[model samples]
Target: MPNSSANQVSVIALTQIGAALARKIQGQLPISQLVLPEKYAVDGEQSFGRCQFKATCQMLFKTSDVVICIMATGIVVRTIAPIIKDKTVDPAVLVIDERANHVISLLSGHVGGANAWTNRIAKLVKADPVITTATDTEHVQALDTLAQRFDGWYPDFKYATKLINGRLAAGDRVNIYIDSDFRGIVTDLTGFTEINEVADDRFDVPLVIISDKTGYPKRQNSIQVIPRVNVLGVGCRKGIPYDAMQAAFVAFCQQHGLTWRSFYQVGSITKKQHENAIHYLAATLNIPVKFYSADNLQTVADHYSQSAFVKKTVGVGNVANTAAELASGSRTFTDRFATDEVTLAASRKKLKVDDS
Candidate 1:
């Protein structure tokens, strides 16, 4: 097993090349994601379910700090490009062509903290990690990296420093979730006071603080950091002719009988021109608009019921499902996000979210 570190990483891909590469990378690194085949996604193993690729990517993007692209063509590019097109949360994006000959560092190489990840993954694979991030290339101070140091890292939070210059500074009451067997989590620097048993949900803890103990459960709820269910995905035209995208999103949530407070973010395709709707929705709710590039979104893939209209409107099927999956880790069939209309899945089963 990989000895996990401060943060978690998830890989998204279905192709033989992608799956093989993901396994190779996970062996050396601790932070990782689930590697699923194209089947067992949408409609079971009956049809090749790349149909919902965009939704799948969105779900994975929500759960990941970085995304590694392994496909070279088709909905992969079309699904991933729109995510990073506008100013956004910028997950670490690295690409390895299907041929496995070269790796390309596309976006957020520094802040997404993929540089160190590359160094670790490159050694496992033959090809070098192609990093284009200026700060990584120049070896400058990264605010995100500085905050994640775990030792006296009291201050750290940002959106896109180079692009839109957005910031989400850290504050008090930051919940830090770790595994039950996490012996080294609680320390003098960490301020965690309790570790309660929650339902079989909750993996989307955005803000985290180090816990100050050592008797973490080997099979407890804290194993999966910020594990949660019911992540809401929002989308609209880039420059959606609206002043309150958050309000609209909230209305949608309310209309659907969703617990408004349960939602952690408002997300969409990364196009500023069409982002007014999503940004408005997020700003109105004072939540973050976690954006991902199309390529970044493709890795996890989606399992939505795709239609011709959906293809024309969303352009891909994998993102929403992908984001939901990421928002709740790889466990997509959580209470609120189940494929069926019924909302209860784990509570009745008495399962826990972080059970290892």
Candidate 2:
């Protein structure tokens, strides 16, 4: 296994047969932990007593990336119904019979990757994989899957996705617009027409637009996928407030015509490694951030605009632009914003679509 779930899994076994089956699965998937009642738990299993099963399941439902329950579909459904919020945020939920005859993708089929995990678990247990998602059943590449494949951010519009995917499954025309810079290598082109620009006259068909730019406004039946190709370099005064940093970044995005989802990573000099505000900002945006040593940032400092005060304080004249350039590993470019407490710069990772 490639550890897609960060090695966090919960296999709920309600009975002896389920426990045996869970053990079989756990043997192959070392990342998965067996969750069973205390009576059924043998050793090295998460044992819950009498009335604790439901609570345990609820807790694991929130924490685990995948929850595979060896129980009736109805039981799993009722147990998780209260906590199920949305497909985007929920964990992959799978249901299997005590005998492991069928592995069903019960919830979060596409975005949470339950469908894929269902197939994997079925293969491991030699069970039939039951996936009911239209895209999977109809043999059409899903819009969300397409976004995920290319590291693009799933658009916030779920209704648009439902309508577009419905049309795609029904063999209707769906236009896909890939911005020149945002179009990475897509392996499939079935059930879609590639268009340079969405025509103003076409309103009957659905449109799928992939880009980091904010040029395409949301239409009646359209989904916009933001490519996570932007790298952010940030610098801030000591103990800068999180709200101020966030406001500055939001302003930067507005000025650049980019969505917050366009950024995949954040970078700053190592001196600000303990900066709580920067870390909070990155966490709020659900983006990973890294810190580079001042020496590493210095190598690229001269390529960008410098500040004497910054050099005197941190031994580097330009933290934001230099950090962005270094993190992106590209030739110098110039896009920066300076605020009273924060300086921010953005660099786009070289687009594969731009390749000749």
Candidate 3:
């Protein structure tokens, strides 16, 4: 499959033949745009002249979702060496020969999706795809790739992943505990034993837990996969500062042993849809904000604590709790807190496989 997660693709070619090959690759990827030197660029195509290739690459590395350098692997390597970041944050980087004979997954093979894009482009142009990730070659799924498949994320502890993938590569059946909600989503369970609980006895073996909750007792060989399933609900006074709202939200999570990473979106009543503080909090969290009308929230308001003042003002007795329950389609709230100025609540959306 083409890398659907990659919204923007930058194809860089320095030579005439490479430019022509890049054009063919770009034809298959409609989201891709060509970047060629002035001498090789066609009309209306992005072009860079003498001493500009390095700067152009640096820009694309930061802005593009996928960077395909159709030139010598070494040149691309040296150019990106200074700007290379962790695979968790870096864009996928691919190297293709001028003749399009091979598409090499040079960097960020798993987490950044280089391997997937390389395979896609190679298939498009009938080229050999060179993917060297050990798990891929050994026909075992890596922890990072597995998380990506389920729209989840692993911790930044690389040692845990390396140990787990190494065990899988050695043909070991790792014990995995996928939350009941996510268990039905995965189609394959070839080399894994699904465990009901994570006990101390399993620490000796490589263990993997996939859940949206926090506080999983894990050893060095354990991999915790956090899916974006939590939905946040907010209620703040008029013109509440962003700092106050954020402080209260963080406090709420900390008190409930929750982490912000698992939150996918924020919910609020339509009466507070124009509230700047809620919008700012959502932006800082890098998640979208969803607004529901007071009438919608009223259906679930009775199940939660209510305030007469709020009901008189916004036509709903509760905002944070009701909004979370309504937006997540959950029958109840997961966590909630209330203060004179701000109120916060959380809910878990119903989990199911989203093939789209």
Candidate 4:
């Protein structure tokens, strides 16, 4: 939310007092404003007109990352009930009292960040946060929060969450096994057991295995967290079809024992910045695409596998390796692989934990 524009919060007020309170809170955060009735509308404020609460909520739910409602709990719940879907995709929803005495996280507390937002608003407005999430109340870290912190992806989160949190609530230790060292993941958190090796007969304890390796052993009461460490540097022939390039890329990762979820980004030369196929692959993987100029790639050319044909055609001996090195700020972790029309290389970026 700080650097990326994808997720934005929307704050809505239903009365003049609520509108005034919303303005005070908005000054402390980045959010869009919506008010009900013409009288409640401050200058430059967007008004939903008379009696359009439900309609406004429907639209905001679809577009906003989080919806902060300054109104009664029952009114907010009834308005959003019909449109409620899966918690993973839904925006965080919070409700505040008109007098700003209590800030309640009404929905999507964990993954959608409603609980965190509630606490933030509460501190700003001098109110109490009514957070009911069991893990938060018990002072234990949530599995989803860990995954977000590491930029890891979880498969079958619902089952994983229920099993892990149930173990924590029952005073059982949950084992965490990470293949690579990641900073700021406090192993000392309550109810967590960091294991160095795979343990036998730990089915009673929930296990969290973090890695990018393929074909890892699966176990009951366990979950896999895929860290995004691999950066893909790609080069393709002009006018190549996206499907062809995508298939090659997938095959390369599969052959190398890498998961697509481990990819942090895709990089390429600036000439391919407008290439539809590269952009398509990036969007499909939900990863960012970074481009570097020929001069930039040339600086790292000595560290890459060079090709005479590529040098003659593109002014660089290697595109994939050079671009990957620039994107990752490190040398290639794996050798460059090539198809007839596309070249792929990979690098691993060091993970920096945010202490703040």
- Model 1: ten consecutive residues of lowest lDDT: 341-350
RMSD (Cα, Å) of candidate 1? 18.6
Model 3 TM-score?
0.77
lDDT of each: 0.45, 0.83, 0.83, 0.83
Highest TM-score scorer: 4
All candidates: TM-score = 0.36, 0.76, 0.77, 0.83
For model 4, the superposed segments whose C-alpha errors exceed 4 Å read 1-7, 34-36, 183-188, 199-204, 236-256, 270-309, 325-332, 335-342, 348-356
Candidate 1 vs candidate 3: which has greater TM-score?
3
Which segments of model 2 are wrong by more than 4 Å? 1-7, 150-156, 197-203, 236-257, 270-312, 325-343, 348-356
Model 1: how far is 235 from its true place, Å?
46
For TM-score, candidate 1 versus 2, the one ahead is 2
Whole-model alpha-carbon lDDT for candidate 3: 0.83
Cα RMSD of all models vs. native, in order, equals 18.6, 5.3, 5.3, 4.1
Supply candidate 1's per-residue lDDT for 166.
Answer: 16
Assess candidate 1 and give its lDDT.
0.45
Error of 1 at 56 (Å): 1.2
